[model samples]
Target: MITITEKEFKQLSEYIKINYGIHLKIEKMALVTGRLHNVLIQAGFKNFTDYYNYVVSDKTGEAVTTLMDKITTNHTFFMREANHFYYFKDNVLPYLTSTVKDKDLRIWCAASSTGEEPYTLAMILDEYFGMNKIWWDTKVLATDISEKVLEIAKNAVYSNERIASLPAHWRAKYFNKINNENSVLIDKIRNEVIYRKFNLMEEVFPFRKTFHTIFCRNVMIYFDNETKIRLVNKLYDHMEYGGYLFIGHSESLNRETTRFKYVMPSVYQKI
Candidate 1:
């Protein structure tokens, strides 16, 4: 493997941080090299600097997409964070049903990873609304930075092990067994989620509608404090009044800097 030099590391690190809001600490040098070495060879680049230049100059942005897929971790599974789903179903759903007169429920799974969180949320929404779901616009907008993962999300196929944590009824209702027990998300549930490639570092959000709920779980841990604060404020601006924000259980907002009302650890309300 071609070892990344100090200058090469700085170039790649700055590019990632500036374009993706990810703070790759100096200690992550080994991680960066490990994750990217294969990509460098696959792309036929001799060294890291050459790869960096190609990523920056590639106007189609496919190179950057590949870079993101290689460098970032997208580890997620069904019911990975169970408590947030409980809160959304039990408390948040009730509030939206009562208050949003038009019943157009706008929910954004901001960092949807490989689809577990958004699909899980979709199932919860389907169950919560039941037959009444047809009467409401409950489709979820699920976005991620990597096109690779977005493709997986669109396909909606998972190994049995991946769906093991899902409730039995949800498994039965929303998934169809195929290829010797691998699960494919049923079209009814799969169609409910709109998947897209989104870069959170984009200065302007460009969302036409303010979301009633945003689940940006686990992704922000890669960001530094300032980046997190800026992103949180951007999320605040894009949310409806009284909208809810769910972060990773381990992630928190500085009460002094953010506009979100403290609801619980990893949960906040836009008031």
Candidate 2:
């Protein structure tokens, strides 16, 4: 395994955050070293600095996106937090439907690594709202800084092992087994989600339409307090009044919970 010097690690971390809004935790040093060393070897670079220069200066600029996808920690599965989904279905949806006069529901899955989280949200929505119901009435916008994961998300295919945690009924309803080894998200459910590339640290969020809910879970644990506050505020800005924001169970609001009153554990509503 290759070792990343402190200097190299700092350089890589800062570059990633500047380009992707992802703060690499110090513990991720091993992860970065393990994942990036092969690419360095493939590029015939002797050290981290050489590889960094090549990545940043590449004409096509695809290397940076590729790097983001590789290094971004994407440890997620369907229904990872069963309670949040339960709350969303039982409490949140009914409330949003009754209060929001538009009758259209929009959700943003910020930092939606790979596709599980956003697609899972789509599955929940489809289960509640008819799959073929008014197309314009419900939509999910899923964005990640990594174009590579976005590609996987668009494919909407997963191994059965990856989906073992999902409810059997949901697995049966939303996914089709392929070749007895893999499963693919049904087109109807997949079509309801829109995937794009977005960086959270951007000065101005470009969303014109507000969301009924936003899922940005498991992402802030890597950020510093200042970055976390900025991200939380930005997410709040794009949410409608009474909108829901779901963070990871292990993460805390770190003094910024004032903007969003805690509704349940790991769940907040933008007040």
Candidate 3:
């Protein structure tokens, strides 16, 4: 196994932080080296420095894309955080139904890794709307920094075990068995999510309209205080007034640094 030297680690860490707002500290050296070792060899690089150089020099941005996919953690499963979904369905949906005059609900899953979180949300929306789904536009915009995960999410296929935690009725309705009992998202549910590759570190968000709800769960744990504050402000700017923001239960927004009104642990509302 190839090891990353101190200088090589600094170079790669700085590059990732500058480009993606992910702060890799010395403690994560093993994590970085372990995840990126195979990537380094497969990309024809003998060492970490050479891999870093190649990633920065590649004008097409594919190298960086691949690098992000390798370094970042995309560990998520269906209904991983079930309480958020329950709150959204029971409280947020009712609020939106009455207040959103346009009847267009724009929800953004900012770190929708491998389709589970966004698809779970979509299924909740489907169940909520039921017979009146045609009267409202409820498609979700699911984005992630890693193209690898985006590709997987777009494919909407998973092992049966991956979806075992989902409700039995939801499992029956939104997914179908394929390739010997592997679950694949049914077309109607899959079509409700639009997956895109997005870098959260971009200085300015390009969306023409604000979102009614945003799920940026568990992704900010890698960012530093400054980066997290700046990103939270950006999200605040792009959210509709009174819109909801759901983050990982372990993540929190500093009351002084963000404009979002704290509603509960891991949940906020645009003021």
Q: RMSD (Cα, Å) of candidate 2?
A: 2.1
Kindly list the per-residue Cα lDDT of model 1 for residues 117-219, writing each as its tens digit: 9999999999999899889999999999999999999999999888989989888889999977698999998999999889999999989999999999998
List model 3 lDDT by residue over 1-271, tens digit each. 8899999999999999999999999998999988888887777778888888888989999988878888888999988889999999999999999999999999999999899999999999999999999999999999999989999999999999898899899888988899676978999999999988889999889899999999999989999999999999899999999899999998999877679999999999997
RMSD of each: 1.0, 2.1, 1.1
lDDT of each: 0.92, 0.84, 0.92
What's the TM-score of each model vs. the native? 0.97, 0.92, 0.97
Pairing residues by index, what is the TM-score of model 3? 0.97
By TM-score: ranked, best first: 1, 3, 2
Model 1: clashing residue pairs? Answer: none
| Decreasing lDDT order of the candidates | 3, 1, 2
Evaluated at residue 197, the lDDT of candidate 3 is: 83
Per-residue lDDT over 1-271 for candidate 2, one digit per residue giving the tens place of the 0 to 100 score: 5578889899989998876667787788888999988988887888888888888898896888778767877777778877888899899988887887767888888877779988887887878877445643777899988887889999999999999898898888889999778999999889989999888888988888888899888888878778888888888888999999999899878544468888877899987
lDDT of 2: 0.84
* Candidate 2 TM-score, C-alpha based: 0.92
